[model samples]
Target: MAKAITQIRRVDPTPEELQAQSITKIIGALAENGESIIKMLDIVSQLDQTGILDALDAILKKRVDVAEIMIQQMNQPTMHKIMKNGMNIFKFLGSLNPEQIRMLMDGVGHGIDKATARESDDKKTSLWSLGKAMKKPEVKESLTMMVSILEGMGESLQREKDHVH
Candidate 1:
């Protein structure tokens, strides 16, 4: 009779070999991301060239003094009014719908264009010319829209008054 046997062996890498392996992996990663690293370095170089880094350093050095001065200015009544007005403007803008804003902008642009075009014409509008313009369909439509807008604003003002009371 014959007997068979199985055996296993293990090999452990030395510390120096492990270090070399790590270095190789690091080099491979550097190669793979070399372009990205170069781009980042270029942006940093631009920032340095523009003196932005120096400005940042200066700001950091005076941070405490700057903060104190800012606090003092903010404590003033003028600053409070400015801040309140800014908030109200933002609130008003927020209240407007995108379509309303678009229409407003379009109206402003058309008004500017008409004004510029009229600069070339030296003709003055007399009562007759005004009556003729009022008879035009486009002019009538614009006047109607303006009246409607003013009515809506008046209603809004009344509502605000009621709410305040």
Candidate 2:
């Protein structure tokens, strides 16, 4: 027959034991990520050699001043207008179909190339020559497209004017 157990002891790790455990975990991590650590060190060495690390450290030291200057610059009226115009441009582009924009850009690029080639040629264009060009299917198609674009733009301007009143 054995006596009944009455006392239970809870053992706590000493400070030295805790420190050793933490060091062990850190060493294990270092071993597991040796290659990544080496690459990170190489990048840091390059940054230090370029003086970029010093610049970054200086910037961090004066972060509040830099932030204030940026805020002041952005608060100007010209900056506000620029931001508004940029937003409007983005909105207009967002409303357009990407495929249509691609086709228009391609046509513009070809037209620019043709114009550049013609620049070296000393060909003079007369009203008669222009009339002859109008007779060509490609020229007629381009003229029709231009007129359609002008009409659409005029209609939009008129609507904007009417809304303003």
Candidate 3:
């Protein structure tokens, strides 16, 4: 006859053993994150001492009511118009090229500097001086650009009207 080996049975932990194991795991975690837990506890203690925690709780409790009131206000016509105008302004800005925007800003700054210099001089330009300035290539180019922009604006307005109708 051949000898046979018996299979071993597994044992479940007792309630006391389970509780001790849980405590051990908790202690291990606390040891690993001791500093972080202390900081969190300090913050919570400060919040409680200052009554900020109660105020925050109160705010959170009435969040739905606050949201409803905000919604009601935002639904008004003036709010709608304000939001629409803000969105349109953003869309307009978004449509502009970055390089062109930079150029426009630079031009505005240069114009401001020129105006300040002119103010400090306090000298009035004669008709002859104005005529001579107008003949400059830079002035001519600027006037041409202005005229083109006005023409483009007129065309765009006409298209918008046609679309609306």
Give the alpha carbon lDDT tens digit for every residue of 1-165 in model 1: 777657666889999999999999999988999999899999999999999989988989999988899999999999999999999999999998989789878987998899889888988869998898999987898899899999999999999999999
Worst 10 residues of 2 by lDDT: 117-126
In candidate 3, what are the lDDT values of residues 1-165, reduced to their tens digit?
Answer: 987869878899999999999999999999999999999999999999999999999979999998899999999999999999999999999999999889878987997899899999979889999999999997897789789989999999999999999
Winner on TM-score between 1 and 3 is: 1
lDDT of each: 0.92, 0.96, 0.94
**Model 2 misplaced regions, further than 4 Å:** 1-8
Write down the lDDT that model 3 would get: 0.94
Task: Tell me the deviation in Å of residue 33 in model 2.
Answer: 3.0
* Candidate number achieving the greatest TM-score relative to the actual structure: 2
- Give the TM-score (vs. native) of candidate 2: 0.82
Against the hidden reference, what TM-scores do the models get?
A: 0.70, 0.82, 0.61
Residue 69, candidate 2: Cα error in Å is 0.5
Candidate 2, 1-165: lDDT as tens digits: 999989989999999999999999999999999999999999999999999999999989999999999999999999999999999999999999999999989988998999889888989878998999999998998889899999999999999999999
Angstrom error of the Cα, residue 113, model 2: value is 1.6
Q: After superposing candidate 3, which stretches have Cα over 4 Å from the reference? A: 1-62
What's the CA error at residue 165 for candidate 1, in Å? Answer: 4.7
Winner by lDDT: 2
How many residue pairs clash in model 1? 0
